[model samples]
Target: MSLTRRSLVEYAAAHFGWRRAYGDTTEIDSLLNEQALTAYTEAADHAALATAKNTDALAVQPGVLDVRGRVLADVLYLEGVLTGARNRGLDPQLIERLDAAVDHGHELTVLLADTVRTTAAVHAAS
Candidate 1:
């Protein structure tokens, strides 16, 4: 299942405890831009596992969530680092895996934050 803004935000809000208003969206961006790629890749690798059907996508359900949760944790842990990098005049290129449709600039941040909040609200409902 591809991650839609509404779905992902809602999932984050509910499963991740993020609020739609004034949500901690930086965490999610960082996860997508940095941490989650690895887990996403790993999840992809397990996609072919026949026994993984009990989970959402692939691998054992618990294992899939575990990987995703680890990525989320990494996003949380690296908050200070990402900020510091930005403070140091680091305009690091975003990972290529991020949606090309999503801008990676200040303007994009504002838009993305709103989208995240909206999704988070939906996730909360679920």
Candidate 2:
């Protein structure tokens, strides 16, 4: 499924204990949307470059790229949230929650990178 602001908000709520009442999510949502758009743009560029480098290469599945982009966008969102909370001097509990969320985001990023690399290798060989 495509990434949505609601999904990201739900993720923040569930994982970081973020509450809409605590802070207006407008800024966060805007940043996330921007990052998501950038991810798609970069993904398209990467796909184009990959295809150009290897005329025989099978087209990379757009879904795979989309998932990769979403994972990256999540990581960036978590990082931004953590930074913003730190800058605002939010409660320690919320900061800790966001810290953990960032750690989880890092883990997700690593896994996604590995998966993409492996998938790309497989695609290149086929």
Name the candidate that leads on TM-score.
2
lDDT of each: 0.52, 0.75
Q: Which candidate achieves the best lDDT against the true structure?
A: 2
Q: Tens digits of per-residue lDDT for model 2 on 9-123?
A: 7688979776554255876787678789999988888777876764532344454567778978988988998999999999999999999988887887787677667767888
Lowest-lDDT window of 10 residues in candidate 1?
94-103
How many pairs in model 1 have backbone atoms within 3 A of each other, for residues 3 or more apart or on separate chains, i.e. clashes? 4
Per-residue CA lDDT of model 1 for 53-106, tens digit only, reads: 533222233443454455555554455456566577565563222223222333
**Error of model 1, residue 80, in angstroms:** 2.6
Each model's total of backbone clashes: 4, 0
User: Which residue pairs clash in candidate 2?
Assistant: none
